[model samples]
Target: MPWILVFLFCLFCAPAQAVTIPGVTTGASASQEKAPPPEPDVEQKKAAYRALADVLENDTSRQELIEQLRKVADTPPKEQVPVITPPEVEDQKTVLENITDVGRHYGEALSSRFAQLYRNLIGSPHKAFNPQTFSNAASHFLILAASVFTLYWLLRLCAWPLYLKMGRWGRKKNREKSSWLHLPLMISAAFVIDLLLLALTLFVGQVLIETLHAGSKTIAFQQGLFLNAFALIEFFKALLRLIFCPRVPDLRPFTIQDESAKYWAVRLSILSGLIGYGLMVAVPIISNQVNVQIGALANVLIMICITVWALYLIFHNKRAITESLLHLADRSLTFFSLFIRAFALVWHWLASAYFIVLCFFSLFDPGNSLKFMMGATFRSLAIIGIAAFVSGLLSRWLSKTITLSPHVQRNYPELQKRVNGWISVSLKVARILTVCVAIMLLLNAWGLFDFWNWLHNGAGEKTVDVLIRIALILFFSAIGWTLLASLIENRLVSDVHGRPLPSARARTLLTLCRNALAVIISTITIMILLSEIGVNIAPLLAGAGALGLAISFGSQTLVKDIITGVFIQFENGMNTGDLVTIGPLTGTVERMSIRSVGVRQDTGAYHIIPWSSITTFANFVRGIGSVVANYDVDRHEDAEKAKQALRAAVEELMEMEDIRGLVIGEPSFAGIVGLTNTAFTLRVSFTTQPLKQWTVRFALDSMVKKHFDLADVRAPVQTYQLLPAPASGTPPTPEEPTL
Candidate 1:
């Protein structure tokens, strides 16, 4: 099998030199002669031709042997389309011949064209100059100039003061607050300045060209020069704005030193102007006046110089790049952040590679190279610009929608943080979608891929179906989850206003159910999506079932707790806020879970008692409770008077509003329930609502003390005394005393 695989690889993957012409080395010296080719072996040549034929016919051989070959002769590959005449069409000269005719006697042609231009310049200087045209152009230029200056002065004088005032207001309203409004104002000012400058510069060029009243060639040259110069100046302005972002150090995103920023900006600006001038201004004019070979050579050399200068500038500012990216990467130090940092480095390298490739094309295939490069460059830039604009609009719209959503802000006030987080994620998805669409459009524009063709194709149809299924699943799942959550929350809120405020147990159960439903919906959606995308989910479901069974067995205690809790709830053994005693722990029932119950004690401490550990359950606050107090009275006191005093106290306690509502019946003074050595016990009892027994008992005790004191009924007390010898006989002790 291994030998067959190797044979197959060798048969299908032939090198270019083995089956076709070897590529010519680019930029070789003119004086260097081409190397003579070696003669090919007859058998090897036959095998090579056979391989080429097999490839062209799309034929495969599973058991073909690799053949040894002699050194082969080299030649240029045949052009698929004729460079000169149309294939199989008319009899016509080649493109090279046409160009030759055009460039015939190049020096004489240039001299004659120059002579004609000079004669025109001399014979009709006044007409060429056109004083009236010059005056009109000058007037327009002056108007544009004045407008530019006025706008500039307005910004410097009025806008600056307004910006400062706004900044102060922001500070006063909320110190250290970063106002979103301020940023837009600052950005708009910079943008206006840049726009006015671009307009003024372009207008000046138009005026100069109109005043010259030059021929088409001169006009083109002037326009190209102006564009190049304007680009360089704009770049410089952008750099300056970036360095002075917010025009306030406090608001600057980056912390680079002014000196470093200024130094790099100067060097970069100089390089930008030099390269832009060479490519846009010098090259076009030189190419117009020069032969094809010289023009190509000059472009190649100039591009090389520009590429080298750009590289130098890039490497020299590596410190600045690193500093800026380090600050960005500091925002997040996760794997994605590291990836972004690495991608930044790779992006710079790719940019350098792009320039290097341009130079290579100019060197070897300069014809229409610039035109093709510009076309692709502009298309790519358009895609980027459009994606950015659309994504920004989408993000802003999403932000606004989230902010204005009554359900999001009102229904789940606690979910404010989550709403903001999801908004950010949604915006990111929107940006990603924009980028994808822009990429497809860009590819279509470049003739690289036809989106409509793909859309109509069989594979594309399948893909679309899968995507639709996924989208539907997500939409329905989200709707179901939201509806379930909202219903649960609303029910909870409604339950709060009932006789007893909504208990944590009810809320907990609803929340758990909602979460469980969400998980179930998400799982089902994922499985369906996977199936739609051609992934089998049957095995996954089987594995999950097995795993769950194994977990159940391993966690028997958990199962026991869940079962016990279910029975407890079904039997209504306890309720949230009920004063329940479970085994040794006693407190108000705070919350109930499938496996455990949370009890909050009077001391504000919580005890989480697992159901498995609860062997006894006592609930004191479930219904009415007896408030019983046993009072000991002195035996010497009249039982009737005590009884009367107790009755009076109970009556007084009943008169109080708080006790009146709590007591189910009048407090009864049951006479002489018990006898002790020191006193007789009287029982007083009353019934009150659950959890109100303590309050009633306290009030009753206070009332009894007051009524007894007023009635002169003595409370039983133990007394100790010391005497002289029992008074040694009673009589004389009165004088000796009270010893």
Candidate 2:
């Protein structure tokens, strides 16, 4: 164990110093030229690692904090981070440059390696190109690629239609299975097509490399080549779509999730450009340009497609949806709110359509189109602004006209629910629109319309663009993440029904989410932003992996805990509202967090438990709990008679005024749960709703005591047992028994 610790410690530890290259002008900051100065920051990072790691190592304390933080850090802020970026990389620009080189290199090398093999097999004077063999291979590749393209388009076209029809049919038949089959089938078909295309591309590549010539028919060879390339990309896009589409049961219904399918065009366009670029790069490397011009043109088309897709996402329509959750805070809204929401929804739909039209105009690039687009955009904005003002005025007037009279206000709840929902939805819309407009303004300043480079310059240009975009994205993401985490934390802790916090449950949950979300966002944002900014993260990732020594020395505990924490959060092993005992200490979980667990003892004190210490946890919160009751009855009564009397007592007690709701049912005798010689004690039990069992049992006891007195049953005389010495050290012990 110690050796393993040492090994892991050495694995992640930062070096003592970051040495400069002495004479390297990488064009970035010197610190970034390599990694930034090895910080004592490693120590801090290592400390963070250890904090979480150690928490996980000890099982005894884990459940304690889970209770405290369970509910605190769970909700989300209004907006999500645009993208996730990593924090570890120092020179994002250089890293992205490397990734571009890598993706480009991979695409090209794969193509070239086959190209050379083809030349070696067929170009040599020793061998003649066989027409029959060439024709067979070319035809096979062409058919396969065409099939793939067809599959992609068919799936893409059918997806939404299938989703709509399947839902309708399922409702008629009342089967959720129909919906799943509908989506999963299309997704699976798309995946199969992708798989076939890949297989065909590989087969064709092998053939081309093995035989240098495309037979005597250049046209046939070109047709086969083009089809194969096109099919390969279409399949890739389709596969990406299927991976992203949501069909899982656990996902919230009717909510806006990421449009995974819409983004396939991004990958397809990128892939197409890569292949086109593949011809360009590989030709330069191997000194051949037979197909550069055609491939380059195709690449341009791919870029154009990519740009259009991005535009679509940017201009997507957003309808006003009510925040059903806000009502948890118990705030009511007014009718002006409702009208504002409706107006906003209509306005946004129109605005989106208008923008889409602008996208089309841009695509056509008619004479003077750039100038026309600029003018049109401004004009559209003006129209939208004016419409919004008018709508706001109209909404106010309508609200004034429709106020409930005082008598009506006093008579109804439904009116308020409807009115409030409308008002709240309206406020949310206004806020969202304000954000959208602001984003547009900011983007326009950066010449955001120009974010589409893949379509403009093809693969070569796209590689550069992707990197720059990533960097720009990451900068904004960090700020947003910080802000959101703050808001959510405040709301959770403050609104917890006035409970004192550092709640083990809520904190545990929050820490889990925060650590995971933060890391993922950081990694993604860094990759994209750095790539966009001209850094290649690939080499860093590669070099990072090959060097076994560096990770060993750094924060071993930090990495271990975070990994464990991610799995724990994903599994949802524990949540709020549990009664858990760790070791001999027992408590109801008050709060939970990744770093520590908080347990609120039955005595009103809190115990903070570290996640690592939780080895043996006893959870009493699940399933139905037992209720215990004790009541004394007269000794003179027959034991059976006394039991019957107590049963009757409960039967009548349940009808009493004060404790009726709390009592679950007539109580049962458990046959002298405890014993004494002088008196009989009856133990009674009943089942009640979870969490209500205790109160019900207490109420029953009160009723039982009250009834016992009314029946004139003599109560047990309290006695303490003691032994001086049995006559022979076993003198007849009192034959006392408890009933």
- For lDDT, the strongest prediction is 1
- lDDT tens digits, residue span 359-444, model 2: 34333332233345445555555555664565555445445524666544444323444455445555555554554554454345
Clashing pairs in 1: none
Clashes of 2: 114
Worst 10 residues of 2 by lDDT: 17-26
lDDT of 1 by residue, 1-739 (tens): 9998985564334332234221211222223335423435666656655644553343222112111122122233452311111112234699998888778877676677556534433452231334564354444434544553455445445545554554455444444455556544554555465556556656665565555534445444445454544555554555455455434333233466666656656766666565555555555544444333344446657878878977776777676676677667777434336645875666667667767766654544444455465567667777876776786576566556345456454545434554555566656666676777787877776567886788779776777787777767766776676667666766566332253435555666666687778788888888888888888999999999999999999999999999998788766788777898877777888778889999998899999999998888888876688887998899889989998999899889989997899888776667789987778988988989888899999998999999999999998878555554454546743433331
Question: Could you say which candidate leads in TM-score?
Answer: 1
Give the whole-model CA lDDT for all candidates, comma-separated: 0.63, 0.52
Error of 2 at 376 (Å): 32
TM-score of each: 0.57, 0.30
RMSD (Cα, Å) of model 2: 30.1
lDDT of 2: 0.52
